[model samples]
Target: MRVSGSGAGSMWLQLLLSLAALWLSDANEPGTAMTTRDINQQTRESISDYTVKGHDLSTSGSHLTTQDFKQQTEENISNLTSAVYSISIDGFSSAPVEENVILYSPANIALLCSLTGTSTDSATVNVTWKKDNERVESSNVTINETKNVLSTQYTLTIRDRNQMGNYTCVFKSDQEVKATFNLQVPQIEGKEHHVVSYVGDSVVLVCKSLKYTPINWIWYMSNGSDQVAVNDSLMPDKYIVDEKYANITKLKIMKISEKDDRSYWCQAVFKLGESKGKVSLKVLTYMTPLKPFLAIAAEVIILVAIIFLYEIYSKKKQMHAGTISCFFK
Candidate 1:
């Protein structure tokens, strides 16, 4: 208890310095490590969050691309399914009196007929649409005019077989113009239109119109470049026209000859127009089938004759050798 003033002061300073050193050591150990750990944890959490956000963005982009592709594919399919079939002509040129259009299936198809014209002077035009020479009530007529050119369009929707016929467009202005489109089902054909037969045998030539019933069936034989009407009255015994059904026609050719090998045309006359089909007839002789067999037989006979000649020559040579040997002995 009885100490000097300087000694006590020095001891107090040392005690303060030791406490300072202890505080500095504690501050540099666990406190600094805790701060560094907190910073590293935050950095790892931020990197994970960024990775998840990037994945979500990529997924959203892919979904949008897929949706756009599907929409475009649907639009393309719609365009192909709703395609329209059409025919066009001009008013100035001479339209054919009859033009055949073959339709396989006449359902869910819209046919557009267009006629364009050019005029020097402005004039009022009257247009009419007809089906099989009768006025069409459901026909849609649209007229467009640009500059001196005029275009008339008519639309007809074919739903069934009955809607197929001749469609005519008539324009009555300074002059009369007519354009006709003959729509018909495809012609019914057999597997083979060619027929082979022998002379003196009967052959039947057939033509069929499965969907349409013709008003009359006419047979025409090709005569050079011209078609000559086949009349049973002229050659009753030679040619016969047998029409048992309205859709079928058969021409029975009796006693076929070399002259019968020609093209025969069958004309089916309908209310709208006429359609023709051809059947070629080839007449052959009975000897034509035997020509190959005769050739084979001739070859066999020649071979046998050669063998017989060789055997006879060998026997004659052996007999001559024996005679010479006996005379020498």
Candidate 2:
């Protein structure tokens, strides 16, 4: 279904009302969808359904599904006609991949795959990947009577890079059962959010998107997924929102104190993906901790040195005056 909006205020009101009615009537209930642009955003504010309960892991964002895994498992029989594949970043691969595959940046071309055929009791399979029809990476795997399924991982990071196009993964068997998957590369965009904090209190980090741009923002901890608050009462005073550029996000601290000095994060969402930035706050103090003792010591040294210098000068003046008087006599 398509949704469009116009400049009229009454039209927006009517649209909201209709959306609410439609959400109440959906089969999966009110808050089940994992999209940002659903028409009934007012009714689906919280993500309670998406939260985990004990050991139950929900596969919401992962591209593969439980049914997909089961189908792949079933396809692998005595003949071993199926393969399971995955791709990721550096140091995460089980085996060595080529250097060009490792050094590929976002400015390069999209990842591609090619398949070839051979017939024997055992077959040697060479898989090649390319960008713009030019070969970039190639790997070889063998399949025989004893082995059927070949599982390999190619470590490559692809997100918000300069390259944009459709990526493909191809698998060819000794027989004619070949499989392919089309993966569209994601694009990158800049996003910024505003956060305010205060001392002896709570703070809400507002991840505001660029004005008139469509993006999704999520707040979470560094080690875990607990959603941090962006409201005022949780932070301390003496905190100032560092509003530098138009993209500057501020943290308002209330009742500034030592407890408020900690690591805080701001995650900005873009159409391509998400990126995070961090800030550290140190509470301000009136004077240095050892300043009082150091100040007294400095004053005593200054007084003694001034007295010693004055005595030396007075003696020298007395000698000079006596010499002058004696010469006249």
Candidate 3:
């Protein structure tokens, strides 16, 4: 039967919704969809001295944080002071107090400097921020004090080299306490992200670092569906071999396909832990209109719907002969 007027529009709307739902359902099917997210974020945050060479892990004014940084600063100062307090008492007197101890992490990209202090008597301490021995009246500096714990943090724009310098955190009470850190933007390492390739074209993804080298490479599709062990042994024309005295791990995907359009990770397995780089492939267009499974599903659904509608029409036709009326509603 021909669909017309409001009824036809309503049916079309429902059909579109159904098709959308079916497309979403395919996301759950094995080997169908790649997880669409910022795969650049490392899942394993459990890091040792984070290292990021040339990129900021976050946007402007966002600082990597640590809870109880004051306590850590105190402990660090105490440890260092205990070892050489007697010898350097006169020479290191101007050294800033352990206001805050922000351990540099190369894995995370962010410019962070902090100050922390504690007072058991009242629950707060007077504090001030500074950079290059000047008073820090800039609104960009953020200060927060909780009960007896006080924390002050400052973050710079990603890769903003001029903004990086000696930052000093000062705490004042009956005595003046100061801490200073010379934060600088260092030369970076590792492949940032995104190497595009078209269908039937080959691509190479490189993952390396200056400080360390990987023992082995583990390759996995970001969607979590396929994980192939990378080795020199030939497998379907894809291969990975140790390059540059086992410093760099390179993966070559031959004759890429639309299915290859997703983020791929090359995890460098080191003795201590692992580090990875996220590389994505972009397929220009598909050789065929729709994937095999989606095409088959659409045909099957169309046939089933036509058969159902025919059965309903036949039943209504028979009922009408007996003076019965029927409607879709």
Q: Can you write out model 3's per-residue Cα lDDT over 1-116, one digit (the tens) per residue?
A: 87679998999899999999998998788887755442333432322224343234556667444545577755654443111010111111245433222222222222232333
| Highest lDDT scorer | 1
Instruction: Supply the global lDDT for candidate 3.
Output: 0.56
Identify the candidate with maximal TM-score: 1
Tens-digit per-residue lDDT, 1-329, candidate 1: 87689999999999999999987887788645446788799988887797666433345445445568699966655454233445555664645344566654433344455446556343577767788899766637766667665556666545455788888767667776676777775565662389999999999999998976777889999989999998689699999998888899899999889999999999887654567898999999999989999999999999999999999999999999999999999
| Cα deviation of 39, candidate 2, in Å | 28
TM-score of every candidate: 0.44, 0.29, 0.32
* lDDT tens digits by residue: candidate 2, 10-45: 678889999988876763675675455664574344
User: Which portions of model 3 show Cα errors greater than 4 Å?
Assistant: 1-188, 224-228, 232-236, 242-244, 286-329
lDDT of each: 0.74, 0.44, 0.56
Off by over 4 Å in 2: 1-109, 112-125, 128-227, 232-248, 270-273, 289-329
| Model 1 regions lying over 4 Å from their true place | 1-109, 112-185, 316-329
Q: Give the winner by lDDT: 1 or 2.
A: 1
List all candidate RMSDs to the true structure.
28.9, 20.9, 36.8
